[model samples]
Target: MFLIRTLHKWFGLVLGVQFLLWALSGAVMALLDHHKVSGEHALLPVAGLQAPAELLPLARVAQAIGQPIQKLQLKPLHDTYVYEATTPQGVKILDAVTGAPMAIDAAKARELAVGRWSGSEPPASVSYISRHTLETRDLPLPIWRVEFADKERHALLVSATTGEVMAAKNDTWRLWDIAWMLHIMDYDDRQSFNHPLIITLGTGAAWLALSGLILLFRSFRRSDVAWVLDGAEALRRRGR
Candidate 1:
């Protein structure tokens, strides 16, 4: 009984704060608007590809580039139609009209941001980042970060190589990320949910619950079992 009581006390002290954090972060995540956090509400409607009368043939482009095309797509980059392809070398963007290879510069990135942004104000700033950061660690590197002047502090991450919108982040998303990191106890990557630390803590919490239940049951009983057994035996011998 004393050992159970001691274990219960220590486990409570250890798990109390973590349990509170889990509940609080869960509540916050549930209450926030998921669409806004995911940037779905801020995405612009892109025009679909048109059936043009003439386009540069993919075979010719592949022959000129001297690389076998693995994937291909026709998409508009800033006001012009381009054939984006993935080849053995890397990603390549070519003009659909003349089959000239296209590259994304800072100015082109800004134009892409303008085309994809549905926000009211223009982008406050556009910058190129070659390395990974805390918020964009999961996304590919050498990307463009476009910031807006809206109240939510919206930012769009565009891939430098593919010209695709990688992710959208704001103040709310940042807070949610922090809460998620705390809830999962994954401080380093902030992405994993099933690491060894969390597993250990979860095991400890289950043990705490079982120990607490045993203590509660012990409280309801009178004396220990030995005293009860001795009294029952005395009554039985007296009767005999």
Candidate 2:
């Protein structure tokens, strides 16, 4: 126990800076909007809808997007249905009723699109455009907007009228944005997890905590013994 406590204290002292950085970074990540890191648009919810149709068919909605919906949640917005969902390619917002895009516009689309091409040259060259991709059909309109943090500089706008993808941006994610992502993705076993730094930091923190607990127990015992001994000595001195 005593050994553990000593080890814990020393571990904390050694790794204190790392923990602090992680903490600060985590806090920033939780609060900072990834889309706004570059000092651009605000991340807003997809808006312009009222409420989702209670009896609507999920299959019909999936067909509207040409893919299976991973998850779908609906909320009420001004007598319309606003839906949030995820797909294999990305996260999305949708309109529960007609599925028309309502939430976003060209400006918001630019913000999401810019992040994806942050490191790339300005004037992104389209490597290829899939002709097979269908034009916007049954998807709802954007009722609100949201900034995503999956990648640098890229954000998505979900529609509020009919659940549809409105616009996206590609650009560079700020330094703080990357830092925040790393902080959240902490794991163990770098080769397996693919993020050695976060794993290393987490492991270091665990070690520090273990050492601290051991030290605390030892200190309590030592203090109790010392107090008893001091009391005995005072009694003896008075007797003498």
Candidate 3:
């Protein structure tokens, strides 16, 4: 019992701050609207596309690019048609009509953002990012960050290479993300929820709870309150 109590005390001291952080972060996450945090409210509706009369043959595109095309997709960015090819080497975007390699420039990225934006106002700014950051750690590098001047101040992340809208973020989403980082105890990358430190702390917390229960039961059995109750019952029985 002494050993268990000591262990519990030390573990509690070590994990108390983490426990508070988890609780606080969990509460904040639960209170915030999930849709807004996920940027669903800022998503633009997909427009219907008319089928083209003719398309460049996959074999010809493969021969020209000198790579085997594993998959192909026809994607429309703004008013232009682009063919996205997934190959063993990497992903490549080409002009759908002319079969020429197409690179997404800042102007094209801004145009794509405007087309996908759900807000009425145009984008406030568009900037190209060549490096990864905490918020965009999961996405591929060299992305376009498109910011809007809407009520939520939403920002859209567009892939410079794939020409795809990768993610959306607002102030609410940023707060939620920070809370999630705290709740998971992942401070470095803020992406992993099941790191070794968290696993160890979780195991310690469980052990502490079980040990506390055992201590409570032992104290109840050993206390004078139990003997007093027994004595009162014996007297009642003798009177009866």
- Which regions in candidate 2 have their CA more than 4 angstroms from the true location? 1-10, 33-167, 170-176, 185-200, 221-240
Model 1 agreement with the true structure over 96-121: per-residue lDDT tens digits: 88888888877777788878888878
In terms of lDDT, model 1 sits at: 0.85
Off by over 4 Å in 1: 49-51, 222-240
lDDT of 2 by residue, 1-240 (tens): 656666676777767876676688777666766555543443334445534336357776677666667877776543356566667865565567676544435443344333332234332222222121111122243233334444443444344333344554434334554564445554321123346665676787887877666565655765678989899999999999
Q: Candidates' lDDT values, in order?
A: 0.85, 0.51, 0.85
Q: RMSD per prediction, one decimal?
A: 5.0, 11.4, 3.2
Runs with alpha carbons beyond 4 Å of true place in candidate 3: 1-3, 54-68, 221-240
Per-residue C-alpha lDDT of model 3 across residues 1-240, encoded as one tens digit per residue: 899889888888988888899999999999999999989878777677775678778777776567887888888766767788898878899878778898888887888888888889888988889988866888998899999998788989989888888888899998998998899989888888789988998998999899888888777753558689889989999999
Query: Model 3 compared with the native: what TM-score?
Result: 0.82
| TM-score, every prediction | 0.86, 0.34, 0.82
